[model samples]
Target: MGKTPAELSIPAASISTEIPDIPVSIPSQLLERRPDIAVAERQVAAANAQIGIAKAAYFPTVNLSATNGFQTGTLSNLFTTAARYWALGPAAFALPLFDAGARGAQMAASIDAFDASVAAYRQTVLTGFQEVEDQLAALRILEQETEIQNKAVALAQEALKLTSNQFQAGTIGYLEVMTAQVVALDNQKAAIALLGQRLDASVLLIKALGGGWQASEIPNRDKIGGKTKWSQFLPIPIR
Candidate 1:
């Protein structure tokens, strides 16, 4: 969409407080959804067809024809007096008996092309798996970091509350309260940044999984306080 983010009607409250529950081991068949894998498979099919064409060159080609009609010698009695007859024979025949060497070379070349296509298809599948694994690993590691950072934020908030109370009672200077405020703010900022990283990882993992995956497959957050659905963050419907 060419529209700005504000035009998309995404609510800030849609942001997930906990990471979505994604499976660590993905099925190999999911890689088939990727466009590059589809293209590579198509190329392999074309190469196999070419091999068939090459093998056909070694076989003989035969052309046959047949005709049946009325035959009469008299022009006036052509329709009334006629004899029924039919003829069938080979009109043309060809067999490259002396060109076996050339045909063999063609067949070899076709086989080579097919092998190359198969290799390319395998490579494409491997690459797709690699990308998905990379994103999954990133999301897993980021989730751990986010959990630890949340604890840090909580501790900072507690510290700030204590410092503010001391300042109000004249037990501490105003400068100490300001320093506590800065530390609490910085921790909150770090927690927010971690959330952003986790969201980014989720998006990339979705992309790597391809469009065929359904939103239902993404497990919702029941362990967390909120029961936010995965579809809330995604703009488009999964196929």
Candidate 2:
């Protein structure tokens, strides 16, 4: 049997349903590649190194010394007994007995610096998450808005055409036609502006994520625990 027109013709409504899904995961992927996070991590590591240096001050300084030499003097002692001298002993040991709390203060300062680095790391991580979330939400909302605006533009254009035809036929006044044209133009301009906004938003998101955007490419979201591990070493949140 041959197909009827109803079966052969594609439905206009189905066109919308056929639209491909947007690549919304780009931002997420960018976030995973963010270099700022790495920089922050390095800062934390540097802070830790400083703390180690400070802590080392609490240990006593140990030194070993050794001296060996052949003594040559006047003819009387030149080769008389083959003069030789050798000495080996612990050179010196100095422990900070009392520095008016200087050593302790230095150690405390190192600790404080480390704590600050930890807090900074946490802030960076939190800011990253927030940026990703905000961009994702904006993208989602804009997608819907764009779809609706597109439909509105189409309807406005159609209305303008109908109104123009009516005015030419003397069924409507010129004012009505002008109003319709203005409405259609406004709708079209709004849609264009919205498209530009979407593009800008995408760019901002890409920047925030740290480039090479791809949301689905992001590592397992579960891996990002709410608490940053660096914070564990700090006694207080760094200002």
Candidate 3:
């Protein structure tokens, strides 16, 4: 974009003025392709993991140790109590019997965090659907407007043709022919601008559809030491 005209070297490309044919209804699962939804889903997972970690604090901790040594390398001496000594015992044990409800409070807070993440994920999904709907509606309306503009352009061109013929016949002045030509040109320009709007709307619709991203690209929770139902984590499926 910053290059000089000589260095630009733009490629040859065809421009399409036709409007795209889009369905009235799209699959809800297509929203899974949205990156925001994916991020929110992962946040929910992380919060769920945090809940488990917090609950672990209520459990006890145990430690064990063992030691064995021989005064002599001889097999006979190894069997003798005077030549060998060994010990095995529980090194430490702790049970959180009383923490003034601190462990309970932590567990509750973690659960609340998980709930919040789930809510956030749902909201993100809703926003994605809204964006898609907005673009689709825009395309539909623009298509209709472009169709009407095309008719106006055709009518203006016909009028300009008639005026030109009258001018050549000397029945109408050149000024009359020029006025008709201006009107035709204006209509043509309006039609082109409408086509541009339709193209813009089409691009926005594709972007709302996640730019071809697939739900399969999302990370699997099963491989991360957990088996969460798809409905529990993401209520929608990848279509």
Candidate 4:
């Protein structure tokens, strides 16, 4: 069947297949593939970068200024060398030897923020794995349940036919025919409900798998350790 645009967005690797005994994924492996976890990882990176920004305050600040203009009030003497004047070389430096431990406090706070992001990322992975497992179990149980319902419906249908034939031949009462009819309808209704449940489970299972996404696609710390440009981050949105 054709896929919707939203469905197409999931990575093909994350989709369900007909193969049996699909292996469960490692926790770290699932963390890499989930976009929510990738976003958390980026938050960690951003928090680490803030640490550098805080440390930068400890460096010296450079003050630079320059001025050049005609000194004479009269417009006539504005172009003359005698009236021309300029001032420069008043640059100064202010080193931040200390800030009453403010820098240290900022660094510590950044470290804590990074740690929190890492913890969030782990929780996201755990939650994602749990959802996948839950759906898998649901699908399995419902599959068997649907099969049983199918058998019940078929039996009910056959019994109803037999009852109808017997009633027409005056071997059974009208009440027996009505009872068989009700049983057949109830079993068929149950089968329909089971089919709907399986569809719901399939969709949930796909979502848990990150729509065919893989963790390897998320960038690691090593990729951002060097001189990186703003444009380099364009290809992948945090989510």
- For candidate 1, lDDT tens digit of each residue in 1-239? 89995578854443447766676456666666666877888799889989998999988989889987778786776665356567897489988879648989999999999999999999988888898889888887888998899899899999999999999999999899889989998998898998889888888877887753454444223421235568755768653
Of the two candidates 3 and 4, the one with more favorable TM-score, higher being better, is 3
Summarize candidate 3's per-residue lDDT along 87-163 as a digit string, tens digits.
Answer: 89858998978889899999999999999999999899888888888987887788788789889989999999999
lDDT of 2 by residue, 6-119 (tens): 579654342222222346334434565577876787788889999898988989998889997767866667555577787898589888787899888999999999999999
Q: In order, what is each prediction's RMSD in angstroms?
A: 13.9, 12.4, 9.1, 11.7
**lDDT minimum window of 10 residues, candidate 2:** 12-21
Model 3 alpha-carbon drift over 4 Å, by segment: 1-25, 65-91, 213-239
Query: Candidate 3 local accuracy as lDDT?
Result: 0.80
Tell me the TM-score of each prediction against the true structure. 0.71, 0.67, 0.72, 0.65
TM-score order of candidates, top first: 3, 1, 2, 4
lDDT of model 1 at residue 229? 68
lDDT of 4 at 153: 88
What lDDT would candidate 1 get against the real structure? 0.80
- Span of 10 residues, lowest total lDDT, candidate 4: 12-21
**How big is the positional error of residue 71 in model 2, measured in Å on the Cα after superposition?**
10
Question: Candidate 4 — what's its lDDT?
Answer: 0.76
| Model 4 alpha-carbon drift over 4 Å, by segment | 1-35, 63-91, 212-239
Model 4, residue 53: distance off in Å is 1.4
Task: Report residue 77 deviation for candidate 1 (angstroms).
Answer: 11
Residue-level lDDT for 65 in candidate 2: 96
Q: Scored by CA lDDT, what does every candidate get?
A: 0.80, 0.76, 0.80, 0.76
